[model samples]
Target: MWIVFDLCVEGADGCEGLAIDSTLDHPDAMWVYSQGNWTHSTFATGDPFVYVQLQEYGNVVEEIDSDSLVVRFGFVKNMPTVINSDLEISFGLPENDVVSLKIYDIQGRVIRQILKNKTLNAGYHSFSWSLFDASGEHVPSGIYFIELKALRSGQREVKKLLVVR
Candidate 1:
């Protein structure tokens, strides 16, 4: 499950894989045991900023030697789906990647490009979008679809937002 995020780091020069040893400056010791493509580890405290090497492919196809990858366990939650003002789209990333947020009409046509190819890091992040379309004019009150796509892995999650004027 953890590997699904790609775990691409920002800048840890010459990193090959996960590690924790006496040489590391981190006080809270950490360890990750891997079997082929899957890994198992534990996090007791503090923000985890570790880098590892990966050969990205498929939706996350990027050839690399070492990437500064730091990740934290996270999820996305939107509040007040039934909205009168702006709608909040809140999500937490496990690593650095391009994220997209869009709204589509009932007919499945994109009405607004709230966010396009925005880069973000791990931990929680949120943005508020009022009920409007690309034209900047307010959209009519009805049911709309909010789409969140992680560009790196091509992973997607959707939610329905109801706007009431």
Candidate 2:
């Protein structure tokens, strides 16, 4: 993610000698610090603009066998009701392998295996979760973690998700 903070000031002489300083107030804002330095531009009418740019970096991978696979997961319904929330995960594999997708609580206990040892080809695939446990019981509303693992490739990926009751 890239954040560009623009500070613009207008004056009779185009904002000459104007200085803008910024402080990050949010945890996500910390990503903007990696941009190193910011440049300021001034106009003849005493107007000035300061820009701060930052870059974000991260990798999400799902192991479906012995290879590393890229994956994406999210909640299908942003605002889900107690009986209709769903979670979705999509991933690509390199070859035919057995893949497993599991949901776990924050305590690291596996709640259920949404996808078991299923053989998949080297292509894109997706699965949707109905927010139910292994016994067909609905889990309480809260934050949960999804773990994707490929047994053949020895690769693994994990992502956080939210479930609303």
- Give the C-alpha lDDT of model 2: 0.59
| Tens-digit lDDT string for candidate 1 (1-165) | 143334444353424354432223454455542222334345545555655454432135565644455443333563676888977778767777788988998899999997799987756788888787899999998888888888996778788878889
- Model 1 worst lDDT window (10 residues): 32-41
- What is the lDDT for 100 in model 2? 88
Model 1 accuracy (lDDT, Cα) = 0.67
C-alpha lDDT score of every prediction, in listed order: 0.67, 0.59
Best by lDDT: 1
Q: Estimate the TM-score of every prediction.
A: 0.53, 0.48
Q: Tens-digit lDDT track for model 2 on 49-85? A: 3433223222234336634544333222233223336
